[model samples]
Target: MKLAYFPGCSLHSSGRDYDKSIRMVLGKLGVDLVEIPDWNCCGATSAHVTDENLAVLLPARNLAIAEGMGLDILAPCSACHQRLVIAEEELKKEKFQKALKETTGKEFAGKIRTLGILEVLMGKVGPEAIEKEIKTPLKGFKVASYYGCLIARIPRVKTFDDRENPTSMDRLVDLTGAEAVDWPFKADCCGASFGITQKPFFHKLSGRLLDGAGDFGAQAIVTVCPFCQLNLEMAGYKEAKETPSRTPLPVMSITQWLALAMGFTAKQAGLSSLLVEPGRLRETVSR
Candidate 1:
């Protein structure tokens, strides 16, 4: 399978782990990911809150590029996936489509579809195929698969699993021989960028997620979004303020976990790059 990969901004920087492991895992699965040239930020919340036209046009530029590549856009970042998909839907409107073409001097056929990495993994690469690729099953491991928001909220937008209680990530976890605990807050919002502008609010929202994962007896929290991973990692510090102190539960990308099961080294899978380190969990998996 060939896909036009859009790493977005965060995936290239703070979310490098998601990028690396996804590339490695996809390569192992015989999937070729062609990076989109000259891709820019999807504008995320900023462009939407600022200028209406900019929001549509910003992601439309990348969509046009992906359309040219003649492949679906595989965006790992939840924000990028949501924005790109939303922009594709918006561009269907004659006004937005005409405006976009006038501004960029390019006609977007709305042909390029934006898909989250989870969708590609669970949908394109079936769980059976993934199970076959696993060299080291995550035996005795237990985790809460956290989907956060963006990926599963809107029913109109194409999503991998249920909007409320997504099990795509959970099933993927099961494929590696890990127990995906039936934990709450699977679709809960982590306050997204609110973690930056409002620390107290961010902590309150993220703290609940962290505390819930521990309360459910999970050893770690598996995530697909970088913002969710970052917020949950920050919550490791703030969680003590609310609940009884416990060992910091590692917040990691789903791809990172899969990479480990697929026999990739810790460094190769970008496990070392996580803010809330998974060293203890890695040691446990090794033994």
Candidate 2:
């Protein structure tokens, strides 16, 4: 299966592990990723907050490029996915379509669909297919599947999973032979860009998530959003330092964990780049 892959800015930078694991695991599943040529930023938090028109147009340009390829887009970053999805919806309207044509000189037919990583996994690549690729099941590892906020909570947009309580990530975690601990914060917001603008508030929000995961006995927190993973890991690290008795839960992209289960080495999956080392994951895989 060939699809247009949009990794966004974070995937190439801070979320290199996510990008590596996604490419490796999808390759194993025979899914070819054709990156959109000259793709621009989706204008996530910044553009959306400052200029609504620019926000829609930014992703609209990328969508127009993908439409030319005649393929659906698989955006690994939840922020990118949300932006692309929102742009597609807006382009369907005559007003935005005209604006896109006038500003960017591009005509978007809105032919392709934008999907999140979780949707691509659960909807396109079934659990049965993934199970067949697992060489080493994470039998004893327990993880809290963190959906963050964007993946399933876009208003007026049809999401793949339940907005209030998503189970796609949990189900995928189960296929990896890891138990997905039931937790309330799976779909909660991780304060997104607030981690930069409002440090203390971000810490308080993310800290609650970390504490909740530990409270539910999760050894690690699994997520699909790069921002969410970074925020959670940063929060986990800070919390650990503040309270030496508390163990920091390693935050991993869902793809990272899947790649490990599919027999890829830690280095190949980019686990070593994580701020908090996944020592428990290594131990569990070794057993």
Candidate 3:
């Protein structure tokens, strides 16, 4: 099962662990990820808001390259997945395709399908297949699976799970034999939008998510999006400092948890990149 892989900008920089864990997990699953050639940024928030055509053109160019490969695209970043999916959907229309071709110098047929790594894991490779690869089942590990707001909000673009109450991450957590705690705010925004400009609102929104997970007695918050993990951890830090009662929960990537349980060490899974350290969780996996 070879697919065109798009790691996006964040995966290579701030989310390097996501790339490492994703590659490790897919390699073990017998799925080959061929990265799209000369892939450019999907222009997630800024491009779309500033220049609409440029936004579409950015992701469309990447999709056009994948179309040549004759394989579906597997995007790891949530924003990249959303941008690519949205670009594909828009390109299907004649008017958008015409403008896109003028800008990108290539006519796009929207032949390639875009899927987040989560969709590929849950649909293309079954959980049972992942279960067979686990060296240590994450028993007694209570995790809050945070999907953020991008992955499944648009059912038309990403039809993998319910937008409001997503359980794909939960199901993946369950495969590790970990307890996926039932908690509200699973799909809530992590306030990535205002993380820089509006610090107070950013902390408030992101802090609430961390607080909610902790309130539910979640030991760790498992997330698929790097922005969410980064923001949540940032907010968690501020939240912990102000409120002594709140113990900062370790925010981990989906693949980080999977890679660790599947016999990969913390260093191998890029656990050191995480802001909030999983001290006990690391100790448990080490033992």
The whole-model lDDT of each prediction reads 0.86, 0.90, 0.87
Worst 10 residues of 3 by lDDT: 152-161
Give the per-residue lDDT of model 3 (tens digit) for 173-217. Answer: 999989999999999999886998899889778878888998998
TM-score per candidate: 0.95, 0.97, 0.96
Tens-digit lDDT track of model 2 for 1-287: 99999989998899988998999999998889999999999999899999989989999999999999999999989999998998888888899999999988988996789988888888998888999999988888889999988999889988999999989999999999989999988888898999989998898899899989999999999999999999998887777788878779999999999998999887787877888878767656643
**What residue pairs are clashing in model 3?**
none
Any runs in candidate 3 off by more than 4 Å, and if so which? 155-158, 240-246
Residue 40 displacement in candidate 3 (angstroms): 0.5
**RMSD after CA superposition, every candidate:** 1.9, 1.2, 1.5
Cα displacement (angstroms), candidate 1, residue 281, comes to 1.3
Best by lDDT: 2
Error of 1 at 168 (Å): 0.3
At residue 140, give the lDDT of candidate 2.
Answer: 86
TM-score of 3: 0.96
lDDT of 2: 0.90
Q: What are the clashing pairs of model 1?
A: none
lDDT of 3 at 206: 88
Model 1 segments beyond 4 Å from truth? 238-245
